[model samples]
Target: MTTPAAADPTPTTGRRAVGGMRALTLATAFAAASGYLVMLVAGRTLGPSDYPLFATYWGAFFALGGVANGLMQETTRAVRSARVGPAAVLPAPGTGGRVRLLPAGLMLGLVLACVVAVSAPAWPRLGLPAFSGVGVAVMAVGILGFSLQAATAGALSGTERWGLYAVLLTVDAALRLGVAGVAWWAGDAGLGFAFATVAGTVTWAVMIALSPATREALTRAVDVGRRRFWRNTASAMLASAGTAALVVGFPVFVTATVRESDPAPLVGAVILAITLTRAPLLVPLTSFQSAIIVYFVQRRELGPRALAGPLGLVTAVGLVGAGAAWL
Candidate 1:
């Protein structure tokens, strides 16, 4: 017979929650620093006009990528939560199920790359300034990298392996810095800065794929319910888009509002201001958002009624943050 749900048998979950918070704190710090570095490096290397354009690349990515991350957060919590049931024994998330998305992720990447390459000429129609064909292609490829990285984050998160998650964040940032440093050296800020993100994420994806745990997760006899997986994926994508609008979609607004040849000094400040203000929310809060999701999921009270109190608090905080960022 299973231990009564009322009796908390595992000290493991409690310990991991505490430890995960620490890792998350560190991860948030790493993400913030690296993101700023990417921005600053591009600014220094690319100069004024190019800076706004590069920022646009990130704006689009993060906004859309939020959905990908949403997928990560929910998947992690759901997968981990499943193991709590005595009969639901399965390979832990980081070990195998993570890579299940790999083939699909790659296909998605390929599709996006083709779209970007094809659309390179019609950028003006998209209202983005015409970038070099290579720059556009690199941008699409970076998006592909981020998709794999985001899913990996979900995998590690599901397993409550905070330390590895922290490493993922730190490594991604550090590698970006290194590659951006190279871009700086090359003095080709535009495409070079784009290269930094692509390189960092590609490597991180490889890192996760090769982990012993991932190997185990794959080789084991697993029971990822087919209907359940697709259902969860659909729900996760919707949540991802909603959450992203709250956080990452700021750039899209900025991109749409500003004219390509507007030549206004305020335009640059607009991008910078949005970034600075959003960082407090996105970097620290959003980066560790899975922790919040997992916490609620574990409690068995994740429904709308249960979430009311916390969501209200988040809304208030978000408003305050927006005002502060605006200032």
Candidate 2:
């Protein structure tokens, strides 16, 4: 008969899995809290009266932001999957890949411009004069800048640089939080909020540039041909857009349909409620996607029956969350 030690092959895998989860839990918590804090500060600063405009732009950002997010998730999965083999070091995603990002980013920028152009004529007629001509301009700039930085984020994800990824996310939140705080204090709440939105994104992108991992990734060559890269990126972006729309589309729609006397108050209330309610559920889900992907990759490394406990815990958490949401 085989002894217990000899029979088991995944010796230390169990510990790694558990330890990974513990560390990820902390990162996810910081990410989640910091994210929601931005919303809280924005809500307090903008107030319900003017918040609907911000909500509209916020929703639009998500809709447009989907491309970057999709790219990041797929890259992460692809990179991590590739590294599961015997190779000790995976090829760092090359620098040339970023040249490809420029066109994609430009395309997104054009889309934003077209959106603003189309909406400009209708905005003032819809009692959104302030937002139509100039407010929309700020939104476009902010979203464009945010989307431009997505490629770097995708590179970070694929390389399994979890610590750097977490730091990037945390800093993004912190920057947004700081911007919101400053806008609120300055009492230029209306325009300042939009400026803060843009500033935070620019700051996040700048911070990521300063990262050693980012610089390293930038030095590498494109892993695949242009045709194949865009093809894959397109599908990933479609899915990402769909997911982001599910979260923000309703707010955008509501704000769009609100009547002229600046029905921002009612629309703002809805946006805030949805934002607050969705945070606990969605933030953790988004934050954990990479970790969950890694978990699957490491499945065979885990001990016998190791997954059972974690799976059970996840199921229990789901049930509790669902019940609470229902209540």
Candidate 3:
């Protein structure tokens, strides 16, 4: 009787999990398709001679945004940990000296902005020949805004607000597509497209104003103390930074090193090919990264067994994708 009672909820739990995944899949697919469209617009508008530079700039911004991704991932873990039944849970957020994420995110954003400003003098030589001080300044502002988005995304993911998270993801991709289209229409050049790249970073602001739940999520506390949170964040950032280099920053590296007879078209072709090929694999994995982490955190008692299913799915998908590409 006890075993039967315990097993009764399994079907309902599986159904909920499947529903959440379907929603996430649709959202991420839209985001991925929007990205491909944005690339097409950039390539057509910027033309061959200039598209490579835009691609490189796009890559560089996302590479730096990897730092913000670290914040999001760490915040997700911390928030989830706090909510779970822990032996030493802190006080409810916004009381008893709990440390909220927004204030910390704002401070970090300011620090990142300062770093970008200080590094402005080297912009021209550092694969940013087309960028003036003003461009760098805009990038700094974008980075500051991105920190807010990261914090909000982490908060929503941690709190199991999957509907809102899917909305956030969809809105972000839509903004990018809309802004890039406007930029092309205005003939704003690579600089305008650069702005388009970071346009979605401020989506969190709108989300906060419109959604009371988002505002409330931001107040949630981390599982750890302030010092420990930052320490863990540092480690996460280092690992994410390495990933950013290999994944997003590869175009920039190829731009620098490849010595083709007609390098402009060659580099552009390589960048486009890489982007199109990698998107199918990387986008879904990245979009679901926070959810996967949360799932594992919830099932930590299951040990390594928790990983087998997701790992097998990824492997099977990779094999199918590889075979498709080969044919």
Candidate 4:
């Protein structure tokens, strides 16, 4: 017979954990919704011509950013979790926190250059070069910025401060949308709109750099031994760059192949359909990836449940969006 006092903590703890999960889910959903609404408004207002270039440039940016950021941050989280048990790790950085920023930046630049070189031939054919060069440069900057943000977010996730991460993401998305909206309203449709995105990324990066956790992380990296730090950072960069190519390369191929025959407007419409389809799934995919990292870190096993949920959501979203496009 368990004592009431003993039994009370189990349910209470369970309730708290459940509540936290719910909050994370809601926050992610809200952020995704806000992003989608902004896209919708931008799409409607800008139409196919304007939106496609923006979308194409953005897609390329994110694909690259995701890979670079994902690899570094994911590796960092895993290493941190292993060194300090997940339960004991603090959400904020402390002395001896591990990250190699400069090497990672260089590797990211190299990868970006390679990606650009591989895709350069098709840019002119697709009319993408008109907007792509500056877009790529901006995206390159964004990749570095996002890598730092992801590192900070990864630390927060390790400590189960996902709610805080979600808040930061929501704020980031809102700021991005607001800036783009203002730019578009001011009659800066194509490249000007793209510049707004660059501004947003810069703003977010500055905010993250100013954050206490991020500042601490940088301080810790200083003592984490330059040699070992660069080694790990390089490995993570390669893995992330590969992952980015896998994700974004397909679209570049598609645009290149399609643009040879299709007009720019038609190409843009197709891209929009793909973008909208993927939009809803981004939230769940992010949640799933974060959950997997945490689960793998703690249990030393993959979370099939998390992986399955996102796959199902993505499949459903793809089907619905495709159908809408066809109609």
Candidate 5:
């Protein structure tokens, strides 16, 4: 008794979905490759003496940014996805349209700034004070940029435009690598490289600002009122910052504990090795995370079947990769 419409194959839709997944996979791969390249170039060009400072800056920026991103992910996946209205998710209008994220941007910024201050004294030994300043600035910008990017990606996933999201990420990575490469080539070791990050952030911010969907989200966020926005943003910041510390703090600890003869190269090599081990897994991880966010939002239940499959796959892949890296 099925109608012809119901019997249709819808093969086109399937193809489009596959295409989107392919794009996302390619984009993530490229981004990881570019990151690896940047690390290699920085280590080789800057050498051990300068590389530590470079590592410090890189670590701080990514760590803070990761925290900001984590907050954004949680907000998009859990809070906002729960249909909890804009007033509960975004910032107030008078606050320059800044999203009133959990953990409040100011509070998060202050904490990050404090961390930077504590870490600043070590910069001179690495060859530059300006590097420290640039590192802080980059981290702050990255916090904003990464959060926005995650928010946008969340929205896109909701709409199932995974391909577009992937493309944007790829573009962002390409820009970062391109800028950093140019700076490294020009022999502007410290400042130039930092400025490149600034450029990339500006580019990403501008792109997000101009996107209609992002603009709409921002508008909703602005209407969400200061209190609610701050509450959520603050929570997100704390969670994100903690996660960031875990990921980036290790290298700093290693540097501190290790001998001073040539710590930079060692740290850089370890980081590079880690990056390589993780690169291939990123696409799957990203896809899995995105899918999980959507599933949790829609279903309100974290089924074991859903969890087991991805977890097993990720663990198996990670183990194999880790083994290879260790070898």
Candidate 6:
């Protein structure tokens, strides 16, 4: 017979879940707002004539980072499943062997960095006159930094360390905003904004150094073996690449399709409009991906029925958003 106190633990657990959700929501809101502000600052600082250059470069950087984002997603699932035991989707880590995901992600990031560097000479032909070898070098460093961030973020999410996860999200966005603000105040243009775009990738390192829990998360092992992890990561990257093309990379396409004969201000305005209009609807949802994945994984025993509530909520939100847009 279960004691009443034991049976009542669900209430406490529910409360904690609610609290964590609030924290995550606040952190996501801050990130979205900060991103919008960064775009605004970039436009003002770079002005109309040069803003398109920065916009195009920004789009390209994120499109490439989609690969890293894919790593993060799989890491989240792999780590969460490992922690949740054998009943979950992915296999659990064991005494037989453990593969640290961060190191693997870093190696992959290095390979990507090399590829980017080797391809730098071709960037100008793709419409980025400013991205010579130096720009590519900066991008390589940013990719490496982001790979570190993605692995750490996945570990944190898998362990259900929502506090640290929220902090990670908040700090990354805040740092980017601060750097952009500094660039704006200093009157630096496209190059400075490029640095700002990639600046937050170092947040994971700082978090790991300051928080012992973050450091401990780095030790968390994924469920899959190395080869399987890489294969899964490649599939995730392909999906994320498509997402990146539709989301951030749309600006790159828009910039590219605009001929030199097109007016510069018009191009910049269209890019900015697309960014601002779409971000509010998408950024928070994207930021919550790990959390959603974790939620569904925990409830996998409930099967497909578990998705009903979230799907309904998303539908409601989408309808409201569409109506607002129409108005």
Best by TM-score: 6
**Local distance difference test scores for all models:** 0.64, 0.61, 0.79, 0.57, 0.57, 0.79
Of the candidates shown, which would achieve the greatest lDDT relative to the real structure? 6
Clashes of 5: 13
Residue-wise lDDT of candidate 4 within 117-214, one digit each (tens)? 56656666654666656665666566566655555555555444444555566666777777777765776667665665544445335545566654
Ranking by TM-score: 6, 3, 1, 2, 5, 4
Models, CA RMSD each: 5.2, 7.3, 5.0, 7.5, 7.2, 4.5
In candidate 3, residue 197 scores what lDDT?
88
> For every model shown, what is its TM-score relative to the native structure?
0.78, 0.75, 0.89, 0.69, 0.71, 0.90
Q: Which 10 residues in a row give candidate 1 its minimum summed lDDT?
A: 1-10
What does candidate 2's lDDT look like per residue over 294-322, in tens digits?
56655756766657866898899999988
In model 1, residue pairs whose N, Cα or C atoms come closer than 3 Å (at least 3 residues apart or on different chains), thus clashing, are 76-158, 95-213, 95-217, 96-217, 96-218
How should the candidates be ordered by lDDT, best one leading? 6, 3, 1, 2, 5, 4
After superposition, candidate 4 runs with Cα above 4 Å error = 1-20, 83-122, 203-250, 301-327
Candidate 4 worst ten-residue window by lDDT = 1-10
Question: Any idea how many clashes model 3 has?
Answer: 0
Task: For model 2, state the Cα shift of residue 148 in Å.
Answer: 3.5
The lowest-lDDT stretch of 10 consecutive residues in candidate 3 is 1-10
Off by over 4 Å in 5: 1-18, 78-130, 217-236, 256-275, 278-288, 315-327
lDDT of 3 by residue, 1-327 (tens): 001111211121467556756777899999999999989899889886678888887887787788778888988888777665524256444433555788777877888888878877766655677866767877888888888788888888777676677888899899989999999899877888888888888899989999998898898766777777787878988999899888987877866665657668767877877887788767787788889878887888999999998989889987997898799
- Candidate 1, residue 43: lDDT: 73
Candidate number that wins on TM-score, 3 or 5 = 3
